[model samples]
Target: MSPSAVLHRQLHQAPTLALSGEGSYITLEDGRRILDATGGAAVSCLGHSNAEVRQAMIDQINQLSYCHTAYFSTKPFEELASLLIESTGEKMSKVYIVSSGSEAMEAAMKLSRQFYLEKANPEPQRTKFIARKQSYHGITIGSLSMGGHKFRRELFEPILLPNVSHVSPCNPYRNRKDGESNEEYIARLADELDAEFQRLGPETVCAFVAEPVVGAAMGCVPSVPGYFKAMKAICEKYGALFILDEVMSGMGRCGTLHAWEQEDVVPDMQTIGKGLGGGYAPIAGLLIGDKVIKTLEESTGSFRHGHTYQGHPVSCAAALAVQRVIQEENLVENVRAMGVLFEEELRKRLSDHPHVGDIRGKGLFWGIELVRDKTTKEPFDPNLQLAFKIQDKGLEAKYSISLYCGQGTADGIAGDHILLAPPYNTTREEIVRIVEVLQAVLEDVFGELKV
Candidate 1:
C-alpha cells in the first residue's frame, strides 16, 4: 500500500488495508486473516462479502441508481419499509429510511419535535429532551446534542444544544446500591426520571431517549428488568415520547430483530442501524409508532422533513436482501440459541480473571468491563487505555482477531470495556475460535503491562 490521501480516524497513523473479507474474517494486504469479532462496530451482522446483499445492490443499480426522493418513491425502500413495519406487527406504523444511524437519530429528534406540534392539542411548549449519562446517540450535530457522552461532547460543549439534559444510566454494576434489590433499584431509577420530568415541567419535555442496550460510552449494557416499562410510564404520564436508540443493539444483534421486543414496551419511536443493511450498504431507519403516525396523519398528513437520499434504492435493496436472508435462514433464532453458547463460553473462560470486572449485555451484544480492583468495582486509570490496548493486541497477526473497544464505562470518562458483537450467523466453531483469540489477546496485553 502506498501513502494515501484518505483522512483516516488517526491522522498520524495509516490503518492496515483490508484486501478482502469472507465469513467472519478480513484478510489484510499482507494476507493475515483477522477474526471480525466486533463486526466493525457491530455493523456487519451478516458478516462481510455476503453474496445476496451484493447481488441485490447490483440489480438495483442496473435498474435505478438515483431518483430525487421528493419527486418519487423507490420500490426497494417501499418494500423495505413494509418489511420493517411488519416486523413490528404494525406497532410501528411507518418507517423513515436514512443513510446512517446518526441520520436516523437526527430524524428521530426532529420527528419528536414535530410530533408535539402536529398533535391534536399541539403543545408547542415541549422543547426539552432528557437522555441518560454514559449514553451515545450519534456524532452529527443534532444527534450529538442529544447524546450524553461527556468526552465526545466536551470539545463541542459550547456549540452543542442546551435543551438536552442527562440523568443516571440504568447500570446496576455501578449505580445500584450494595444492598439494593433489582426491584428497588428500578423503582429508584423510575423516581429519578419522574423527578427530572417534573423539574423540567413535564409539559416542556418532548421525549426521553435512551439505548435499550447502551453502546460506546457504557459499552453494551442492557437495562434491568421492567426498566423500560417503568421509564415509558413516566413518559406517558408526562405525555412525552419514549424513544429507544437501537443503532448498536437492534436488528437481531440482541437475539430479536428489535431489542425493545425483549423489553416489553413499545417505544413511541425507535432508531435502528448498523445491522439494518448489514454493512452491505450505509442504511438506517426510524420506526414511528401509531401515536406519532396518527398525529401526523390527522394534523399535517406529512412529516416536515426531507433528505436527498431519503430512500436510496440501492441501499434499500441491499438491506431488503440482507433482511430476507436473515428471515429465510432463521438466523435470528440462531442468535438466541448461539447467544446462550457464546455467553457460556465467555463466562466459563474469563469469569475468574482478576481484572475482568463485569460481563454485561444481551444476546450477541456483550461487554467486558475492566477494573483495577474488582472488589471495589473501581475502574482503571483512564491514562492506561486498557480497552484500546486489548483491541490493538487482537489486531496483531499473532492473536489475529478484532474487538471493539470503549472507554468511560464506569462514568462518562473513567472505565474501560471491550465489545463483542460477532455476526449473527456465526458458527459454533467460529465462536470458540473467537473466544480463544480473545483470551490470548487479553493475556498478552495484561502480560505486557505486568499488572
Candidate 2:
C-alpha cells in the first residue's frame, strides 16, 4: 500500500477516495458513481448538490468568513439563532453553536454540570450520570464516558471520565421477550432504570442522558411507545436533569424538527447536529431550556465553558439558509409523509428475505438488520463483516449508500445492521430507487454467502 493509503485509511481492506459528489451521488477518482443514502452519517439533509446552499456559502465567504467571538457576532450567527428559537418555540430560548456534535455534547455536559453548581446544588454528591447501554453520544472524553457503545469505549476504558453508569436500552427486537406485551416490556425497562437510579443513589446523579431515538449504536431504533415519557418521569422523580442527544436523530430527521416532540417530552438540555447544517457547514449546538438557563443566570451570570469557534458566521449563515429551506419548502412535512413511505417500501422489498431479521426505524431513518437465521434471530459471525460486504455491493451497483456499521447490535460484540437515512426532502422516486438498489445489492451479497 502507498504511505498515504496505509496511514490515512479507516478500513484497511476497503478502497478510500471521494473525488467529488452531486445530488445523491458521490463520484470516486476512478470515475465510479454511487448514490449517497445515509448522507455521510445522516448529516446531509439537503443532499450533495444544492445550488442555493452552495451559493449561500460562497456569498458569505465574499462578505466574511471567520470572526472571533470576542470581537463581534455576525448577521448570519444572530439570524440563525433567531430562526432556530422561533422554530423550536419558546422552550429552547438560547442557542450555543459549536463546530460539531462532539463539541456540542461536551458543551452540554459542562453546561449541565455548571447549571447544577450555579443553582447552589453545589452538593458534590450530584456528580454522576446515567446513560443507556448500546448508545453513542460522541467521541470526546465527557461524551465518550456518557456513551455505552462497547466497541467505541473498549480501549479508552481506563482513562474515561468517571461516574457514568448505564442501564438496559429500550430495544424490543432483541431485548423484548416472546410473550411480553409492549406495556409490560416498557414497565420492565422503566423499572430497570429506576433500579439503576436507586443503585447509584439518585442524589449522586446529575442527569440521565439518552438519544431520543437511539442511533448508530442500535440501528436507528425508536423507543417502543411511552419509553421516553417514562424515562423523563424517572429523571424528574429524582433531581437529575434529562439530556437528549439528538445529534443524529434531530433536526427533522424524525418528521418533527425535534425528536423529543414525538415523545411528548422536553429535555432540560439537548444536543443537535447533523441536519442542523444540512451538511452545508460544520455546525452543532445545545438547545438550553428555561430552567437550566435560569439557574445559570441567577447564579453564575455566564456559562463557564466557551469555544473559539463556538458560533462561526459563515457556518451559521449556511445553516441558517439550510433551516430556512426546510421551513419554506415544508420539508419536515415531506419527511413525515415520505418517512412512512420509505419504511413501508423497505418492508415490502426486504422484510421476507431469509437473512433479513428485523427492519425498524422512524421518519427517514431506517435500519435493515441482517441475520444468519431469522427463526432464531442469529446474526452472522462478526468476522464475516456482512454489513460492509453489502455496502460494497451497493456501491458497485452505483449507489453511494452509507452503511452505519457497528458490531454488538446483537450482543455488543457481534451482529450487523445497515442504517439508511436519506435526505428529508428526498423525492418518492429517490426513495423507491434507494430501496430498489438496496434490495438488489442485499439479495446478491446474501445469496452469494448462502452458496
Candidate 3:
C-alpha cells in the first residue's frame, strides 16, 4: 500500500477502503464482502445503507441543512427532542444534543455542575465526580477523566482532571466472591460507593456516573441484579446526582429503548449515543431529569453551555427517522428475539472451548472472554494481543467477518474478549453466521497457540 495522507487510528497500518455497505455487510474496494457484526463499535443499529435514514437525511438537506441553535430551532430538532423525552415517559424533560458520545458525556458532566450552581442552596464545593473502573465514557478530556479505562488513560493521566474518582465496576465474573449471593454483592458495592462519597465529603461530590451495561472497556458486561438501584440509592443518600452513560448500550441495543429500563432505576441525568442515529449521522445527547430542569428553571433558566452544532437539523432528522423505523419495523423486538438465539449459539459452540472463559451480555450485545486457563479464569498475556489477532483473522478473506475486540477485562492490560453487537434488525440466519464465523476464528487462533 502507498503512504496514506489520512492519520488513521493505527499509525503503522492503513485500513482497507470500504466501497459500499448494504444490510449487514460492507463491500471492500477489493470486492470482498465482510459481515459487520459489531456495527463499527455498536453505532450502526440500523445496519449499513439504510434507505429510510438516507431518504430522511436527503429530505432534510433539501429543506434546511444547518441552523444555529442559538438563533433558531428546526423542526427536526424540536421533534427529536420531543420524541426522546416522550420515549423516556417524561422522566427526562429536556435533551442537549451534540455530535458524539464524548461530547454528550462532557455536556452531562458540565450540566451536573451547573445544576448544583443554579440551585437555591448552591453547593460550591460539589466539584467532584465518581465513575467506575474499566468503564469507558468517551475520549474528550472531561469524559476521559471520568472514565476508568486504565489502558486508554495511561498516556494522558498527567493531564487528566483530578476531580474524578473510580470504584470497582459491577462485574460478577471476576469480582463476585466465591459464595457471595447477588444481594450481598450488590450491597457490598453500594457500601463501597458510599464510603468513597464519605471519604471525599458527600457535599463535595456532584454526581456518580456509570453505564447501566458496561461497553467497550469491559466488553458488554451488565451489572448484577439490583446493582443500579443500590447505587442510585447511595447517590440519593449523599444528595448527589445519578448519571448514566448509555452511549453503547442505549437506543435499543440492549433489547430496550433504554438499558436502564431493565435495571429498574432512572438516572437523574443520562447520556445516549451510538444507536441513536443508527450511523446515519454523528449525534448524541444528554437527557435531563426533572430535578435538574427544575433547578435551571428557577435559577439561571439556561444551561451555561453551547455548541456550534448542538442540534444539527440533518443529524436530528436522521435520528428521528431511525427511531421511527425502529418503531415501525419493531426492530427492538427483533433484537430481543435474536439476542436469545445469539447467546444460545455462542454458549453452545464456545462454552466448552479450553480458552473461552465467559460468554455474557443482553439483547443483541454479547461478549466472549478468552482465557489462557479456563479453570483458573486467567486472561491471556497482554504481549500476545490475542483479541486483536482474533479480530484481524476474522476479517481475513477466508472468514470475511468483523468482530469487535477489547482488552483489559481482567485488569487494565490483560484479558481478551470479542464483542458482537449486530444490528437491531439482524436476522436469525445472520446470528448463526456470526457465531459460526466466530467459532471458526477462535478454533484457528487457539489451535495456532496450542492451548
Best by lDDT: 3
C-alpha TM-scores of all predictions: 0.98, 0.96, 0.99
| Winner by TM-score | 3
How far residue 269's Cα lies from its native spot in candidate 1, in Å, is 0.4
- Candidate 1 per-residue lDDT, tens place, 178-252, comes to 899989999999999999998889999999999999977887888999999999999999899999999999999
lDDT of 3: 0.93
Error of 3 at 282 (Å): 0.4
* Candidates sorted by lDDT, best first: 3, 1, 2
Residue 55 alpha-carbon offset, candidate 3, angstroms: 0.7
Clashing residue pair totals per candidate (backbone < 3 A): 0, 5, 0
- For model 2, the superposed segments whose C-alpha errors exceed 4 Å read 5-7, 11-15, 397-402
Question: Which whole-number lDDT from 0 to 100 does residue 244 have in model 1?
Answer: 96
Models sorted by TM-score, best on top: 3, 1, 2
lDDT of 2: 0.86
Q: How far is candidate 1 from the true structure (C-alpha RMSD, Å)?
A: 1.2
* Residue 52 displacement (Å), model 3: 1.1
